[model samples]
Target: MPMRTRDSSGRRLATLAVCCAIVVLVLAAVAMPVAGHAYLSDSDPANGDRLEALPETVTLEFSGDGVQVADVTVTGPDGEDVSGDAVIDPDDDRLVSVSLERDDTDADGIYTVDWEILAEDGHTTAGSFFFSVGDEPVDRESVLEAYADDEDDVSIATTAAKGALLLAVVALVGVPVTAAVAVYPVVGRFGVAPSVVDRRLTRVLAGAGVVLFGAVLALGVARSASIGSSGLSLEAIRTFAATPLGHVWLVQLLVAALVATGLLAGVRGSLDRRYWLGSSLAGAVVVQATVSWTSHSATLVDRLQGVTVDFAHVAGAGLWLGGLCVLAAVLPTVLADAEAGDRDRLAADAIRRYSIVALTGVTLALLTGLILAVWHAPTLAHLAETTYGTALSAKVLLVVAALGLGGFTRFVLLRRLDPDRERSALERRVRGRGSSGRGSDGRVRENGGREAGDDPTVDETASTTSTLVTRVLSLEVALLVLVVVLSGLLTSTPTAVVAEQTDAGDPVTLEREYDDGIVELTVGSPSVWGEHGSAFVDEGEPVVFDVTFTSASDGDPLESDRPVTILAHNERADTQLQFDLEATEEPGTYSTVQTLPDPLWWELRVSGSPEGTYVSEWVDVYAVPDGHEHVHEYAPLEETGFTHLLRIGAIVVGITGSLAVAVETVRFGRRQR
Candidate 1:
């Protein structure tokens, strides 16, 4: 081995170590308690309360800390404002209040309260409720219909910006990882040094870095435009800059600069070759970590765990899918430029090395992906019901397609590229006859004016095999790019399980303890039912149950098990049913799907044996109307017209692109077969 090759190996190890250390730091530091959107926990003169006398002041308490009231209004039956300015409590930021300006002269039937709050993390939540003060009680449905802001449309430009940023990160990080772990080492063994590939690949790295920097800037502008009451104004930008989300953007900007500058310096030959590779890799990890912070993972209850899994997930994607992209871009060019004799060895070795790296990355991505899906959806109903679920489902389908393509590549295409097999066949054919050196056809043949041991037939076979592998890898790369974009959409969209309950209605919760006092169970019924006209579930529709088991002594979640047994009795129809619940990836959470065959009144009895002791828990009754379709309806806003088009367009494009990739993959498989 040459000294330069030894040095290159040492540098690769060092680069990998630096990346691992940076990942650890990210997992620790990003857990600094970034808050999620604030939700109303309780309010004075509570929602739909029929009060004989009006109160002096109305107060609201929220679920998240550091929440500040942005706007509040109280409307009387006569359609006039009758409330003072909203004020945040000094002792508890999550508490807000506004005094009523009503008088004896005022005649009231219904009073409506509407408010919007901004959480510390910069996202806003707004809602409406009603109270009655006269002989007529509050009509909840009427109030909601008149005052609720029904626009739930996500901004198209923002999601696009996010997708672009995600793609840029994958490209920027992926090239370096692929080169270090897969390309450089194998090529160097065949006498193609890292310095040699660096000279040829510098422009590609620089281009990826520049794209990433631009993407970071685009995300900031898009985010500002998408904010409420702050459409890209300087003040709006300043306000955003003061929040935790703004801080994440700032960090993204800095890291993007680091990555672009490092790669550019290497391209310009201004940085030391020994240090640039490691520095660029370390910068890539930081970029990926910052990108994870901008996702919905930051909104999870366990912010640290969510962020960590997200980081690992994207990093693995960068390694496998991103690396495939790098290979697709570089390998063909390298093969085209290499001497014919060297091409076979180079392609074979490079593919073999990258297969292992791709395998590692794919494994990490799939495992983390499963964890994230459970955290976001929790149940099949959630996966099928929400907008977030729709995007995730689409992404999962694409991933399955990619996995099929990858499986064929690894097991079939790659195996055919075995250089040793081709060489062995050539040798046997050339040396088949004992003294005469006749070919495999049993006839003496001339070398055809070609060099000894050079067979055109074997060379043609190697070239064809290499070409097939390249085409398949290219298709796989394209598929993964779509996956990354969908991942971006997922980050911007609300979680399937959490958001479904918020918009649909509050889920009913039941709690009970086991006889041994070692286990406690908390079960949350589905949000398919609501008071007034907002109800969702109909007869014979699937209902999901979210169950959690906790240790009685410590109040911590108990170990996961198959311990839940739910029995439902329809008192009106004299029908009863029993079923079991399955555990979810979330530590102590379990979920199951069942259907209520009849409408109107039903009672539930939940039981479990978590600690070798059976515990029966009492749950509340549920009501559903018969012969009604279970459908979710979103109220549209005037401003959401273009944004809605953009969102719909994105979905259409994703579906179309995925189908095209699948068709091409299938065609390619048929050709190989």
Candidate 2:
């Protein structure tokens, strides 16, 4: 009776183990890839070059994703005012162009360009550069590009290191959880494989949390380097360290140490303390929360959604992988015993229970994954067209395949292998075979020996089958990791889109030489001509300009097509008025405006030409605060505050969420202990 009872328990436990293993394997195979692949590449102006004239647009290029141009600014020499317009390229969503007014280019000095680009992968890259105009010399020693280069290098290094660490942690933690679930018959009373798997997986998830914490620290260093700023002073460190992101690394380090210690102690048989388990579990949860901050989950609402999805993702992965470990190691051992019937029954029961749990985990994984996609992507087009989206699709497909396998194992195989009925039939077949060649007693002995002895063929077949299944599941998990790495890359801006949309077409120069004695003015308009006129302007209007002057050679009223007149309006008004002077008949410079209405208040006025008129000779004209007398130019492109905030917010949220998860995990462990 005692042996039978033990056999029954063993069989039930094996069944539970198989079921949990199936579910955990499926989840891991699906979720990890979806999380890793996000990043950025390429930018406009080609890094560094001297421009013949200022470019009206700035664009960026990416390998496989798309980007949103957040902002662009141009500051001229003397830090004075210049005519410039910033706007998105109508033809491409990724490009951002800025157009400067022709009149504002009078100052000959270096111009600084600063910009920000947001990638589809939910991260942002921002930096500044400078270029010389006219006769101004370029600064050869500037480290702006070096800083930008550092940003990319540091980000890649940090992400890779962190990702590797996370993978290791997940694997280590999952091992124990899998073992626990597999050995549940010996450990617990009920068929709660799903709950057990979940609990164990959660504890192991702390490994990933710790890895994420490391990533946050690496990112901060990268950010500081990119900015060309230094001073790891207490204040600087505190400023960064105090944030949810800064503390994530510190927390992860502590949690990792604790988890390692606990795991080692447990392995050595010295740590039977339940607190170790609790601490490990709590630490993992904290890590999950802290790492989430590095994602787009900084705000309360986003964080809540992120937390829910992340939990599902993490827990699902653990359960799937851990369950597989059990099915491979523990189930067969219990099945090959003398009281095979009872052992088989227990194993079958456990398998049945585990199937349900795995199904639930897979379901949660799918739902949460979809929610995350919807929240972050926001558009179907983005999902279909972006690199991030493509990786996500691949991950989804793998998950479906895993689910299908699980379904086959559950509904078809489990039902057919019904221990209550099948055991009897199998027993009859074996007994009959044995009886055909021997006496009843001899046949019974032969049957018992066959069941008890370890035959190479039977063992080989079972191991081969289990190994094949495990290999397939492991492949799925590996693909998931690739998907995650791609996701990280996708988060970076798409240089191609930005380049196409924001590149300034060609420069159109219109020059007019006026014989003004007092002012030898060679008025010129460097207009940006593109497929669309507004590509080079801020007010979403075409680039337009006007230049006018008066004659200083002769202090006499000049002739006009209709008449010649001078009305002195102010002391600063041009003393000599000339109109219709013998200037060459150019399309934009045919006629000139001369005259003033005196008390010396109103200056000479030229009407009728869209590009404005130029005086034939040099004449001093008074500068007016609100006057349009000299030359007026306009480039139409406008930037809104909302767009700026949106891009900035995305970057902040992503970085912050990643760090927060790390810190929370540490705090959780401390409290638990």
Candidate 3:
């Protein structure tokens, strides 16, 4: 009995260790930064600085990871905007140069310089600086421009750094959590010593946590460097350390230490319940806090939603991955033991238990994942067309593969090959045969020693089978880690700065008004130009209708009748308005209003023809806002059709399936003896 127990304990320990290792590796890989073009640093003129002469041009220096800018702009002191011919520096694609037209900037007033650069990450960052030409003095424009520049500078670095940090933490915590829940039942059914398994698992978790913490610190340093900070200062450190997020990181470090201590104690056969609980709670808290900071949990409603979903995601992941670890590590060791019968029973039980837990974990993960995806994405197009959407799709595919593997293990391998009652009967028969005076093929027992070449003992076969299962499960666990890491990356905003560069353009507006029973329209476009044509509204012809209404006792129009109209006109075409008008039936005073079909310049003719005629006003409808140059036309829903619905349905189904599997696994574990 003692020997059998020891073998079981060793197997359990091995299983937990493997599970923890897989989690660590997955999280680390997810945290690794993708190699791409990026802006390493930048130097622009300080805002509100006084210069003796107008510089020939504004120069912007940046490091690109893999992106290039097509143009840059400079708005002069006289409100004359100039765009320099943009070119990549000969030395590096990362560096770009723009040449502004040299104008006499000798006047002593403030000038605004704006730069638009494409980051290697495929996002665009734009900012402006203000400097005084000549030696006049500082003014309101200079101060406002200087302040704006400072705000932009701070925003860019802070947002990027925070985003990166959040991504890292999610990957690190998600993998192990997923694996533990998935394989929990298998680990439990193995009948391995819980103490040994817990000890090894704790050690793995602690060690990995510490390593990840160090990696995070290193990442912070790298981010700072990218932001052009040469050396860390007390203020900088304080800025990071004083925040709620900083406290979370500190807690993570502390939890890692506690986990290490707990593992050490368990290994020494001095495991304390308080220490174990404390470590687990602390570790969980750290993960939770990190999620709050990294996710959209800053707002009250979002916080509630995020916390719930994030917790579910983490817990489900841990249960699946952790259980897998225990199964993989211990199964081989148990199978190698001399007591082959016990090994067989243990392996069978473990597999059964793990299968159930894994199913449940998957189910929960799927459900919560769906909710999160919907909440974050909001629209079907975002899920299918955006970078985040594509990554999510990949994650779903991986999950499906994992689930299929799990199903095969449960239905074919466990249920068919290792039915509990069938295995018990076989064990009884083997024992009876060995106890009886039976030899190979029912012959006399001449030598008395079991024939070495004869049928192997039940225990031996069970151990071998267990070992094989462990190997297979280990592979599954590895794949799961990959999924978790990919998930972390997916949660981040995938639209990079470089991609935003192409989207920069001008603004256009469309406006129409009905006054004194006539429809009038106006269209305006910004002077700025881009590839897209400016927005222009055109109408067919003014359709006239009238509304009659009564005046109130207070002399105000009681029942005012108004019409909708659209007036359309382009720069090269004559403008016209199509109008729909309604008449009011109120007594004492009646009025009529009309609407134009298009937005453009139009004349409204209001007449009580040959009796009471009142002509009241011509209004210009502006199509575009001043200083903007372009507008995006909205595509009707018919254009996209049911593609969006299909995508959304798929996401929902995938998430639901994962949840169902996870729940079933947990119930199976609870029912197991």
Return the top candidate by lDDT: 1
TM-score of 3: 0.52
Steric clash count of candidate 3: 117
Q: Could you give candidate 1's per-residue lDDT for residues 1-673 as a string of tens digits?
A: 4545534443443344335434433353223222235666557876555577888999987764356334678998889999998887878777889999978456467887877765544345677766778677333233334223323335677678778877877776677777775677666666655666777567777777787888888877765654445467887677666656678778888888987898899899898665666666677688778766545555443556666768878877877787787678778877776777777777766765565456546655665565565445555666688887789989989988998988887677665666656656665664564333546654444345332236678678778878888898899988998999998788766666446545544443455567444333332222244543223343553355666766777767655434677788888899998868777777666667555677776667766655555667655545556433232221111222333333344334334433433343333334223
Off by over 4 Å in 3: 1-195, 219-235, 260-274, 297-301, 334-338, 377-385, 416-464, 495-673
User: How does each model score on TM-score?
Assistant: 0.66, 0.48, 0.52
Each prediction's whole-model lDDT (CA): 0.63, 0.41, 0.44
- Model 1, runs deviating above 4 Å: 1-38, 52-57, 63-70, 76-109, 117-124, 134-141, 146-153, 190-196, 272-276, 427-452, 503-673
Better of 2 and 3 by lDDT: 3
Q: Which of candidates 1 and 3 is the stronger one according to TM-score?
A: 1
**Which portions of model 2 miss their true places by more than 4 Å?**
1-110, 115-124, 129-154, 165-182, 186-244, 299-301, 325-350, 412-418, 424-537, 540-673
Superior candidate under TM-score, 1 versus 2:
1
By TM-score, rank the candidates, best first.
1, 3, 2
Q: What would the per-residue lDDT of candidate 2 be over residues 305-386, giving only the tens digit for each residue?
A: 4455555555555455445444544455434431432443444454554443344344444444544553344344445765
Better of 2 and 3 by TM-score: 3
